[model samples]
Target: MTNTENQARPIFPFTAIIGQEEMKLALILNVIDPKIGGVMIMGDRGTGKSTTIRAIADLLPEIEVVADDLFNSHVSDYDLMSDFVKNQINRGKELLTKWIKVPMVDLPLGATEDRLCGTIDIEKALSEGVKTFEPGLLAKANRGILYVDEVNLLDDHLVDILLDSSASGWNTVEREGISIRHPSRFVLVGSGNPEEGELRPQLLDRFGMHAEIRTVKEPSLRVRIVEQRSDFDKNPEACIDKFREQQIKLKENILLAQSKLPNVIIDYSLRVKISEICSILNVDGLRGDIVTNRAAKAFAAYQGREEVTLNDIKTIITLCLRHRLRKDPLDTIDSGSKVDRVVGEVIGDV
Candidate 1:
């Protein structure tokens, strides 16, 4: 797409999304620290799960990439490039750069492995007797967002591919006498209705946060949602214009949080609390401990604070570790409430 077309594409305003604050905050925090990993959103249909994700992507800042590069390789990703790309950079040639929107790539349910991870150029191989690597969705998604709608319905093998790529930050494609690797760093956002099916445990563990959303219950809020959506459907451009200022402020806030993230401090006591809470809840692996710490730090940065606070952890505990809980048949409490109770017992109320 041309830059002009990209800029002109209308998106629902992030600030105007009626509710689903948990999902919105999770997305914002992921943008701040992709290292915190990605989020899994389980909710009812038409609860704005996909809409909120797209809105968050729309508000993200543009990315800088090597102009004309097939893999959307940024300067930092130079080391992970294919030998062909590396050769171009090795010569005394200045690489041109271009600014593009942060990719929000959809991983459709039926996508083939070759299409998802790219494949060999069969025609080029036949005609030129040379092997060339074709890029895939993962390559395009580098330094951006990879969204999977109805993620629970995705095939197990494809789920494994996503997990592998997410864990290693690399997507390796090996075909007939050809292999290539590229940076595949991205915030993996998956949304699905729980009533459809349960996610695989391994894949669930990979996600940094989990949030469940529901339909709006308040009568007034529901009316407002209807009105705003109707207005946007009537004139998308006008709705975008109306929320332009708030969107800009939110974008600026994210940029500022990113800059501030490195300096945000996590005190030892908070670290102890994170571990203690995870231990109390019997969550497996250190992923819970690590993600909670990173999330709290990001929350501090988002709030323009230099140090982590108990409140930061309190606000984010459910998002960070709810999906990590093991089910107990005897315990009737929902996982979210269990997390709250455990957190309260371990750390007291913030």
Candidate 2:
């Protein structure tokens, strides 16, 4: 984000959000291990998709960015952040330190491609007779979260660009006489109403996991969620204080999960079993199998388990690989239900 947008921030706190435990867990899991890929939340409207992202604003670690660098590139990590920042001395813009938080930037549905990738500042270059590049949303999203609302409705061209940049971990532009390459290594979080539109398969595969969120059906749970949200909205400080302990515990859990993830063991037999599951489902890519195993291992670690087991694999199969599966054209399909049934027959019985 630019120096201007940094001045503006989200109003809600992540811990105070309510009624979407699965969605919340999925995001937290991604944060603990970004290798889990990224999260895609498709559900009904008003289910706190946007709110969940906004609330996470205060939950991330504060980072040090280049003073005026567009991508919020880390100052100390400049050796690896981007070529644009590396060539600052030749460009005559002195690199200064400007520490900023891990941002959660929202890309609106109506935003154009130029605005996202950035366009040449004709006024400055022509009138002043000098070259300058204007920063866009991607620049601000580096090393943070890039949130796209109603992502299914995004234009096809934009979707292609997003897929490429997200997969490559950088964005390169050669237009308007400005050839620039910069880092764009943010976790892509997208929420949309699947009924309204469908996400392109190419882009869908880019996301690591798919989380389906629905409003709470239980009256008591729904009421509690509303009451808590209302109470927090009315008195922010008091509500934050009450939930401070939960937040602290949650952060600690995340740190523990990160340390334990690499240590979680997945044996050859289990790897073969995971591959069998993917093969049975006719999933097309190796990425699905890889992500499923990683997520299962991560889940085991999160629950403080030392060894990977059948239950962990079963629990995370749907979250990890369902979105990447090939859809059955004739059958009225429930991907999650199918994943569960396969686990029950194959892994559960074992």
Candidate 3:
């Protein structure tokens, strides 16, 4: 397809999406601060979970990369480049650059480990008497979004690989006496229906924030969703054009938030409050504390504020701590409610 045609293929605008406010907010906050880790969404089907995620691609700003770099290495990521690429640069060749969309790759449920983590180029090694490496989904996902639609259904081994790469920001493959390591940093967004199965706790905790999405229950809201979606389906281009201005503005806001994040400050009192809430919830580790701080700061930045506030903490606490709660077999309530109750008890409900 022509570039124009490709660009013209309509996607539901991020601003035009109906309900699921928590899911949308979680995504936006992650864009503002990817270090908050990634978001896991569990809810009923047809709640616009994947639709909301796909719409986010329209809002992403383009990134600068070294031209022809297979790994999408940024100018600042030179040290992380593979040896051959580094050697070429060391020979005084002027590095070429290009502007491309930040990658947003979908990891399929049936994907193999080799495809997910890259494999050795066996054919080339055997035919040419030279070793070569092939990049995979993890490579394509570098500095981008790696989305898993049915994350709960992923195999245990792939889950472990994702967890390792996520924690370390690198994917290493060692086979046939060749070891290759490359940057694999990306915001991981996963969605699944709880009715299918429960996500493993170890994998669950890997997500920085968790949001529960529900089908729109209000008739008025439901009607609005149907109408907007109908308009888009009838004439996608026109619908997209109508929201073009708002989409551009959102993109600009995200860029501004990113630039302002370094200046957004977190104070000692908020830190203590985060620790206290986590402690009250009996959270297992400091991940809860760290994600809470990062998410609140990102929210503050997104709202053009200079510092994190108690309200910021309250706004994001549920998402940060909900999934981290230790399972209580005797407790009948959900983790989200438990988190809210603890927050209300500890911080007095901003």
Candidate 4:
């Protein structure tokens, strides 16, 4: 589908989502600070994981991009622009820009490596002496969200490629000595049912936060969710209209959070304590510490605060550190509970 058509598609309102607050918060914080890395959501099937993701993407504010740019090259930021865009700027060419909804590229479970990463046409290069490059899902996902459903089943090599590009904020394609590179920065979101399988520890640790969701057990809440879905299915437009005000406020809050994230700071003592928890838990690397700090700051910014609070860290600590803990086949305690126990020991009833 065309970009316009994709943006125009009706999506369930983010504010209207009834449960899965942890998953929603993780997503919002990532949008506020992409530096937090991204979120990995694990839950039961039909628990609204995909719906919640789509809602957040729909709720995001539009961004300006170079007109007709395949990579959605940032209008003014040099780091976010493609090499072609940079060359244009160097030549003093005026850039035409347009505002568009944030792209949300879904990665199919069976996608080939070449489809995930753009391919260079070697035959065209030899025939015409000009490299023909075709941008793939990674290019479309730049400056937006790249969501992978059933991620536990994705190939390990593909997961490695995604993590590498996510870390480097760029994708490079080379074929027959022809090479192309472009910005591929995006918030990588992956969701899956735990019953199928678990992602390898190393790959899971790459995600900034891990949100665990479950099917709603409360009958009343379940009924409400069902009713809401039925309402939307009956008349999507009217249902969206009902939550229009709330959606607007949420969108505004996200935009403000993004603007305020850079100024949000965590106290030195708190930083020390965060690392202490990671160290005590034997978390493999400094990623747990770094992501926790960033997630805490993003949480504070989302709350309209300029300084990180102990409460903010307490709220998101589990999401940041749970998946990073070394799993013991013998230990039955939950990873999230283990992280929380460490937080209590280190932060002391905060």
Model 4 alpha-carbon drift over 4 Å, by segment: 1-7, 122-129, 327-335
Could you estimate the TM-score for every candidate? 0.94, 0.88, 0.94, 0.95
The order of the candidates by lDDT, greatest first, is 4, 1, 3, 2
lDDT of 3 at 197: 78
Off by over 4 Å in 1: 1-8, 76-85, 327-335
Residue-level lDDT of model 2, residues 87-162, one tens digit each, is: 7755787678876767778888888887788777779989998777776788777777889888988887887776
Candidate 3 on 1-350: residue-level lDDT in tens? Answer: 67887675577999999778899999999988888988999899988988888889758988887888788887656644655567667887777889988888999999999999998888998999888888999999888888999898999799889867876778999877889888888888989998887676666877899989988889999999999999999998899899999999999898999999999999998899899988887888799999999999999999899899989888998999888774652322255888888788878946
lDDT of 3: 0.86
Q: Write the per-residue lDDT of candidate 1 for residues 1-350, one digit (tens) a residue.
A: 78877675677899999888899999999999988889999888888887888999989989888887887777556644545567777885677888999989999888989888999888998999988887889998888899999988999788888877876788888898777878888899998887787776667878889988889999999999999999999999899999999999999999999999999999998899899999988898999999999999999999999999999999998999888884542322255988899888988965
Supply candidate 2's per-residue lDDT for 223: 92
Cα miss at 29, model 4 (Å)?
A: 0.4
Would you give me the overall lDDT of model 1?
Answer: 0.86
The Cα error of candidate 3 at residue 232, in Å, is 1.0
lDDT of each: 0.86, 0.77, 0.86, 0.90
Best-first order by TM-score? 4, 3, 1, 2
